[model samples]
Target: LLYALLHLSGFEDVSMEEVKNFRQWGSKTPGHPEFGHTAGVDATTGPLGQGISTATGFAQAERFLAAKYNREGFNIFDHYTYVICGDGDLMEGVSSEAASYAGLQKLDK
Candidate 1:
């Protein structure tokens, strides 16, 4: 599911081996969706709510980079952040906490 999303996001050059090897062998996707370890992943997340929480960071970073580097015509660093949080996200307190934090930070986009 995630691989398809990455492909749709224009990560055409991404590969399965790269995704599987993002983290050390022992890790389950290295505890989450690791952006740093994978070629096209946007963040490393786990513990249910972590994925959405990290999305906020990635979105903020995207905005920061766009504002810092994009010129009047050049719109580099502009992209949307997406997350498919599971049922567990709402059941867990940490998930609510992350959601609250995102809301408090005004990360609407």
Candidate 2:
């Protein structure tokens, strides 16, 4: 569903057939989404809180880059980081810690 959504939303790299073959051996889709391994997967998310935590890190990096390089009128680093997490993710301690840090940094995503 997530991959489908991404594809429908214009992420052309997302393959529906790969997602259909999810978890199968030798398939592009794995048991969990791997960032570089999968075409459109943004993060590895086998563990409950891993995705959110990784997204927080990505958001921090974006903020740092924007602060260091973005000009007043020419916004070079103007991307947003988004994360989708479930109840299990919210229950994890790692998620709590990551969320706290993101909140402190004022990460909108």
Instruction: RMSD for all candidates, in order, please.
Output: 4.3, 1.8
Q: Taking the tens digit of each residue's C-alpha lDDT, what string does model 1 give over 1-109?
A: 6754564566644455544654557433443666675456656666777777677777788878888999988888767877788898778877787778778877766
- Which candidate achieves the best lDDT against the true structure? 2
Q: Count the backbone clashes (under 3 Å) in each candidate.
A: 3, 0
For candidate 2, write residues 1-109 as lDDT tens digits: 6676666777656567766877789877676777787566777788899888999999999889998999999899999888888899999999999999999989984
Give me the overall lDDT of model 2: 0.81
**Residue 19, candidate 2: alpha-carbon lDDT:** 63
- After the best TM-score superposition of candidate 2, give how far the Cα of residue 76 lies from its true spot, in angstroms: 1.3
Q: Say which candidate scores most in TM-score.
A: 2
Model 1 worst lDDT run, 10 consecutive residues: 22-31
On the 0 to 100 scale, the lDDT of residue 108 in model 2 is 86
